[model samples]
Target: MTDLASLLPGRFGHLVRQLGAFGGVGVIGLLVDMAVVWLCLRGAGLNPYAARAVSFLVAATTTWVLNRAFTFRGARPEAAHRQWAKFLAANAVGGAVNYGVYAALVSGVGFFAAVPEAAVAVGSLAGLGFNFTASRTLVFRGA
Candidate 1:
């Protein structure tokens, strides 16, 4: 019998490495989202919630491109656009969950005054697993 690892293509290892790299990309996107949300609310006069929604869109889009290029490099070409749309839809759910969690952590616990970044981090981390799983299964289903 063949080894399970050998059953997969050579790029399987590369895909795993790319997952780590895409995670770094996600981190950058998160920073951009946070900065934009903060600036829009605190500096630009937009409503706080509005700023967060807008920033989330921008960040999710950025992550999608990086993920397509890196994490799922072996994804099928014919379904690429459809996969991206599904990915974005899944991310919308994740983004909403993240925003809700952050809002609760900030308002319910009043952590914003002391550590606003902590709230964002906690929220985003909570949503990360769900997002990844859904994106892999529903969006970029390689099988």
Candidate 2:
């Protein structure tokens, strides 16, 4: 397969590569988010809203670990716990946007209420750009 970065303009190749890596990590996080939400709802008998909150935290943590290891490996090194905290804080804005869209869909749409994972997918896409930018500039700033 042709490298995605090679298809982009030279000036943007590095950024496109990073975005591709981030997007790959995000896809894993989305799967994690959907699974957690489904399990919480089906196994634990939690409400959709509560399940989503739990799932978001789990997914965010998963993405943070993966992004640190793969997406932004050159990120400034810091204490692991401290970096994790920073990652959470920086992503909160994107998370709120993500959650807001999810909440609206689940509360207002019957289909989304019945299939919350679908809502989760939509919400994740909504927040993708914001999350990528915040993560890159705020949480993972380095060479």
Candidate 3:
């Protein structure tokens, strides 16, 4: 009881550090995704959903590269092709989570009716946990 509670805090503290690092990676990835989305949709006249997919692809690639170099750098290299394939698969799931949140906020909440800021806010909050957990376990697993 008491011992379990003490261990819980220690375990949680370690998780907090990992989550923080994971979030730092996510922040950079989000910026990349948003920038590409803006350029493709606003500048190139692509549909919003299509733009989001392309942007997510680009951002996912960037996230993998960065996470390899930073978050999971200590892991012994798996086979190159296998590792990349797994990373891409993980990103596919994360992208689904991300796009779902964006769509829900923008459409379900009528974020388009209220303001762009509301959409961004709601989507970010909704997708944060999915992105963090997926990237941690699937993308950056310790070897």
Candidate 4:
């Protein structure tokens, strides 16, 4: 099968590949977020808002690890702790956007309140562009 990068023109191919990889990582992150939220809400007896906050942190950490290992593997190296911190700090805007969407959906919509994972998915997508841009430019420059 032809590679995805080859299907695109010039540097756009590389960007497309990066976006694909980032999207894959984002899927994993969404799963992690959903699972964590479910566990927090059900097992830990937390409110939806509180569960979402906990889940977001967990999911962010998960994505940072995966993005470092796979999505932006070609990026220049730094201390692990430092890079992780930078990743978190750099993606804060995206995280806020993600959380705001989730909070609004869960608070305003009965379906989302009952099915928080669905809200998580929506929030994840809402922040996808911002997260990818921040990851590529600020957290993982040159990748």
**Against the true structure, whose TM-score is highest?**
4
Query: What's the C-alpha lDDT at position 126 in model 2?
Result: 78
The CA lDDT of each predicted structure is 0.76, 0.89, 0.72, 0.90
- Candidate 1 backbone collisions, by pair: none
Tell me which of candidates 2 and 3 scores higher on lDDT.
2
Cα misplacement distance, residue 47 of candidate 4 (Å): 2.4
Give per-residue CA lDDT, model 4, range 100-124, as digits (tens).
Answer: 9999999999999999999998997
- What TM-scores do the predictions have? 0.63, 0.75, 0.63, 0.76
Residue 116, candidate 3: alpha-carbon lDDT: 61
Tens digits of lDDT, candidate 1, 42-77: 898899889988897788778878777777666666
Candidate 3 regions exceeding 4 Å error are: 1-14, 95-126
**lDDT tens string, model 2, 20-125?**
8999998898899999999999999999999999998899899999999988899888888887888888778887888899999999999999999999989988
Tens-place lDDT per residue, model 3, 8-107, is: 5775765676666667887898899999999998899999999988997888788777777776676565776676677778667666676677777667
lDDT of 4: 0.90
Worst 10 residues of 1 by lDDT: 13-22
- For model 2, what is the C-alpha lDDT against the true structure? 0.89
